[model samples]
Structures are given as C-alpha cells and as structure tokens.
Target: MKRALPILAVLVVLLAAIAVANPFFLEPAGFLAFLKRAAPLVILAAGQYFVIVSGEFDLSVGSLVTAEVVIAARLIDGDESATWPVIALLIVIGLLVGLVNGVVTTKLRVPSFIVTLGMLLILSGAVFLWTGGAPRGALSEGFRVFGRGGLGPVPWSVLILLAVGAAAIWLMRADFGKTLMATGDNERAAALSGVRVDRAKIFAFMLSGLAAAVAAILLGGFAGVSAQVGQGLEFSAITAVVLGGVVLGGGRGSVLAAMAGAFTLEALFTLLNLYGISGALEFTVQGVIIIAAVAAGAIRLPWKFTPRKGDAHAAS
Candidate 1:
C-alpha cells in the first residue's frame, strides 16, 4: 500500500486535471467512458506486472494482441454465432504463445528479452503474411458489445476491467505471488528454498499472454479491424509498469501501483489530446517516462554510506 501511493496520487491528479479541462469528465457517463477507453491497457499492465515482478519481460504481448484480433476477424467473419468460439480460440492462442515463450526461455535457457522479442517478430510476420498488409472481414456486433456496449449506464469494458483488476490484486496476495516475488528477488535462493522458479516464471508469461488476448478482444470491438491495432502496446505496458515504480529488473512492486500507472498514463494521454497534442508523440512520451522512472529508481541518497568489503560479503 505504501509503495502504491505515489502512482495512485498521480492518477488522482490526472483525473482532476481532466475534469478541470473537460467539465464533462466529472459526470458519471464521462468517467465511465474514460474507464472503458483505458481498460485494455490497464489489463495489459496488470499482466506485465506479473512477468516483471517475476524477473522477466514479455515483449510479445503487443504482437500477440495483433495476431489475436486478426485471427478473430478471419475466423468469425462477422458471424454472430462464431463470436464465443473464436474468443475461446483467441484465449487458447494466447496461452499457447505464452507457454511456448516460457518453455523456450526457461527450458532452453534463452534470455527472456531475446525469446519474447523473437516471438514478437514471429507473430508480427505471421499477421502480415495472413493479411497481406490489409486485414479482412469484420467483428460481429455481439463481439463488439464487449468493447463498445455497456450494461445500462456502465460499459462492459469497465466491468471487465474491474474484474481483471480484482483478480490481479487477489493473485498477488496469494501464495503463488509470494513465491513469484521470491524468485524474482533471487532465483537461486528461491530454488534452494524449494520454489519451482521455472514453473513460476512460465506461469507469469502465460498470464501476460492471457492479458494480451483479453486486450485484443476489447480492441477488436472498440477500434475495429486494423493491421496495426496493437502497435507499440508493448512499450506502453512497460512504461506504465515503470511509472508505477516497479524496477525494470524486477523483484519489487505492487500490482495496484502498476494498474494505477496504467490509468495515470491513459489520463495523461487524454489530457494531452484535449490540449491538442499530436498522437504521434505518444511513443516519445512513453520513452521519456520509462527512462525517467528507471533513472529515479537507480538514484541513491548522498547520505547513504558505501558498503565496506566485509559488509558487502555479509549482505550477500
């Protein structure tokens, strides 16, 4: 809770600023709509939180999201009856990709950075080959409801976001979450203490994949079909996580902070758009945030004493 305060505070300030800039934002309808818009990225951040806290990275999620949307469109082809089935297939594809990433990284001893980057390229190439630079077909209205429609006054995406957020909080409080943190902090120590480091890391990757699948569903419905639907989301999620004060190399951070970071980011973008900022600069902004956050984390106070040789040895 203590670690999460800064990000949460930032979210509040952003929301307040939005309200000031756009008075409509203070209305219930406006706020709910904002949540709906931010849902996918927040969920992605949650998933990324798991992997980062477990001492790994998932660069493939953005590409995986693109693949899922493309596959859903081709398979469903606007057939209402196919909505559920295709959604299920998308989930399976996400898990399978995550599983393969996990297996290759852990079992084959490949660095996660390389493995996921490769997966990202592989998925991106597959999407291009399948679509030939242009996506075909359309999403069913039934499917679109999840992204654009709502239950009465509330959007379904908002509901889904709440559910995902709750689940992430719960998961991080469970035994698995503790073990995951331990593994990230020190893999060898975790293993010596009987933790299944490989399995934990693999599961974390799978969770990230699942998050990407869900994000694709919302995006497919909300934004319609596009070859670039999921472009640059990987960096966005990472930036969000870093903004939440999660160290890049992992081992520390709260899930709530991570989610708050996502919301803060979305709010920032919204504010920027309202102020007439170019959308093209989103990537530049994210890059700056990531670098700033990581650098802030690396800073040490001048008053902190340097460790003596024996002190370092004892600490280790």
Candidate 2:
C-alpha cells in the first residue's frame, strides 16, 4: 500500500484535472484515448522499472526507440511483406544493444550511467548519419497496427500494455526479481549468496531496451516517424518511474505503480494542453520532478537504516 500511495494520489489529481478541463473527459472514448496515448510510456516505464529497481539506468532507450522506428521505415519502405521480419530484426537489435550496455557496466566495471549515456550519443549520431536529415521510407499499415490500430473499441496498445504489466509484476514476484532486489540492497552480500549479480543487472538493462523497442513501435504509429520522434524520452520515462516512487539506486518500488506513473504523466500533459499550457514547460517540470524524487528517496535512508546504539552510528 505504501508503494502505491504516490501513484494513487497522482492519478486522482490528474483525473480531477481532466474532469475540470473538459466534462467529456469522463466519457469512454476520452478515457480510452488517454489510455491509448499513455500505453507506450507505461510499457516503457515498466521496462525501465526493472533496470532502475535493479540499481542501474538505461539512457540508450530513447535513441534506441528513434533508431528502431527509423530502421523500421527504411527496411519496410511500405512493403507490407517486410513488417514481421523487420520487427524481428528490431527486437534483435534491441537485445544486442541491451546486451552491450549490460556487459560494459557489469563486466567492464564501468558505471551504467556513463555507459548508457555513451550509448545514447552513439545511437543519436548513427541515426543522424544514416538519415542525413529527413527519415527515409514510411511504416506500412500492418506495421502501424500496434501503435494506432485497435479491436473494435479497444486499442491493441492498451492490451499490450496490460500484458507487459502483468508480466513485469510476475517477474518482480519471481526468484529473479527477489535476487535483483537483494543485489540492489547490497551487491556484495548478494554476490556472496550466489545470486549471479552480473547476470541480474544485464537482464534489467535488456528489459529496458526491449521496452524502448516496444515504445518505438507504438509511437511510430501514433506520432509518426521523424528524426527526433523520441528525443528526451529517456528522461520522460525515468521521471515517470521516479514519480511512481521507485528509488533511483533501486531495491525499492513496484512495477504496477510505475505503470500508473506513466498514466499520470500522460494525463497531466493532456490537462496542460487543455489549459493552454505551453508544451515547452513540460521538460522543465520533468527535470524538477526527477531531482526532487531522487532527493526524497535519499531522505528516507536514515530512517530505513536506523540502527541500535553502537551498531552503526552515534545518535546526535
């Protein structure tokens, strides 16, 4: 319950704002549209939650999403026949990128923050070099289905988000998730317990990459393709995750809440747009939220680790 309070509060606030901005927001379609728009970010947040709760970051995801969309367009080129294979290739690429990020951070002993940042730059530069300026080709209809298509009244993206959310929750309740939490709580102790610390972190990063790829597919369909479609998305996902109450250094959050955080973010943006708020200020809000969330997490450490006298610290 404690894990879900922040998300619940955010959700209630956002819903109230929506109701105030436009009475129609209470209608089914309004809510469905909101869910559809939020689907990608929610999925991405779940994926990012794995990495974050495991004690790392995956900055490459934003550019990876851009790259996935671009590569999809170039390879598909309106050829419906190419969609599945190209998607498979994109998944492989995402896995490879995640694998590389994981390896460098775990085996090479580099900070994941630095390694993923380097990856973000590398991916952005590569996309720029390959596309020149405008992206080539277009996404075929079949390929676009995941993003914009739905079954009668329900969007496929929403369904997919539900599936991923279920899976993420299941993973968090499994042995791997338990091991990951232990690792995050204390890597040395986890390693000593035969937790395969390196492997857990790698898997977390891989999940983030996989999330980025999935987000890219939906975004490509809804927002359309561009050289900059996913710019700043990493920060957005991270912010949503943090707002869900997941601590930055890991071992302290819930996937369900993280998904809720994504929804809250989308609703907030929609409310802002309804109120004629400039989109430009969105990033400023995210920056402040990220810092504040992290700092708030830090403030709890003393209480969480309160020790008996002469155990660890001398009370003032």
Candidate 3:
C-alpha cells in the first residue's frame, strides 16, 4: 500500500488538473468515459505487474494484443454468432504465447527479455503476413459492446477493469502470489524452500497473456481493428509499472501500485492533451520516466536489500 501511495497521489492530482482544465471531467459521465478509455491499459499493467514482480518481462503482450485483435476481426468477420468462440480463441492464443515464452525462458535457459522480444517479432510478422499489410473483416456489434457499451451510466469496460483489479489483488494475496514474490526476491532461496520457481514464472506469463487478450477485446471495440492497435503498448505497460514504484529486474512492488501507475499515466496523457501538447511527445515522456524510475530503484536497492537480524530467524 505504501509503495502505491505516491502513484495514487499523482493520479488524484492529475485528475484534479484535468477537471480544472476541462470541467466536463468533473461530471459522472465524463469521468466514467475516461475510465473506459483507460481500462485496457490499466488491465494490461496489472497483468504486466505479475510478470514483473515475479522477476520477468512480457514484451510480447503488446504484439499479442495486436494479434488477438487481428485474429478476432478475421475469425468473427462481423458474424454475430462467431463472437464468443473467437473471444475464447483469443484467450487461448494469449495463453499459448505466454506459455511458449515461459517454457523457453525457464526450461531452455534463454533470458525472458530475449524470449519475449522474439515473440513480439514473431507475432508482428504473423499478423503482417496474414493481413498482407491491411487487416480485413469487421467487428460485430456484440463484439464491440464490451468496449463501447455500458450498463446505465457505468461502462462495461469499467466493470471489467474492476473485476480484473480485484482478481489481481486477491491473487497477490494468495499462496501463489507469496511464492511469486519470494521467487523474484531470491529464486535460489525460494526453490530451496520448496517453491516451484519455474512454475510460478510460467503462471505469471500465462496471466500476462490473459491480460493481453482482455485488453485486446476492449481495445478492439474501442479503437477498432488495426495492425497498429497494440503498437508500443508493451513499453507503455512497462513504463506504467515502473512509474508505480515497481522495481525492474523484478522482486518488488504491489499490484495496486502498478494499476495506479496506469491511471496516473492515462491522466498524464489527458493533461498533455488538454495543454495542447503534441501526442508525438508521448513516447519521449515515457522514455524519460522509465530511465528515471530504473535509476531511482537502483539508488534504493541497498536499503531494500539489506537484511534485518529478524529475517534470518524468520527464515529459520
């Protein structure tokens, strides 16, 4: 909770600023709309948090999202009856991608960074090849409903975000979550203590993939289908996680903080837009934020790593 406070504060401040700049944001309708728009990224950040906290990366998720959308558009092809099956298939695809990444990295001894990067390329190339430079087919209204529709004043996307957030928090509080943290903090010690470190990592990758699938669903309906839909989302998710005070090279931070970081990021973009800043500067801002975050984490490492006398006793 402490780690998440800074980002939460930042988010609140940014929201206030946006409200001032555009009073419409103060309204329920406008606010929910904002949440709807930010939900996909927030969900992706939550998924990325699992992998990051467990000492890994999931660069393939961005491209995975793109692939999911492209695949969905093709499979469903505006056929209302095909929507659910395609959605299910997308989830499966996400899991498969994550599984391969985890297996290759953990079993084959390839670095996760390399594994996921390669995955990103493979997915991108596959999408390009399949689509032949332009994606065909249309999304059915039933498919778009998840991204564009709401129950009364509340959005379906926002509801999905809440569910995902709650699940992420709960999972982090469960046994698997504890083991994952331990694995990230000290893999050898965790393994010695009976934790299946590799398995946990594989699960993390799977969760990330699932998150990508959900995000794709929301994004496809909200932003429509395109090869560029998930472009650079991987970096954006990473940036959000680090900004939330999660350390890189893994083993620290809270899922709550990671989600807050996503909200803060969305708010920052809203602020920039209100101020008439060029959207092209978005990547530049993200680069600066990531570097600063990693540097900050490095500076704090010694304090975080130093063991208290009780730690040894507690382990024993």
Give the alpha carbon lDDT tens digit for every residue of 28-134 in model 1.
99999899999999999999999999889999999999999998998889899999999999999999999999999899999999999999999999888988877
Model 3, runs deviating above 4 Å = 289-316
Q: Each candidate: what lDDT?
A: 0.89, 0.86, 0.90
Order of quality (lDDT): 3, 1, 2
Best by the lDDT measure: 3
Task: Give residue 159's lDDT in candidate 2 (0 to 100).
Answer: 86
Residue-by-residue lDDT tens digits, candidate 3, 49-93: 999988889899899999999999988998999999999999999
Candidate 1 residue spans exceeding 4 A from truth: 281-286, 297-316
Tens digits of per-residue lDDT, candidate 2, 39-113, equal 988988988898998889888888999999999999899999999999889888888899999999999999999
Candidate 3 contains a number of clashing pairs equal to 0
After superposition, the stretches of candidate 2 with alpha carbons farther than 4 Å from their true spots are 285-316
User: Which pairs of residues have clashing backbones in candidate 3?
Assistant: none
Each candidate's clash count: 0, 0, 0
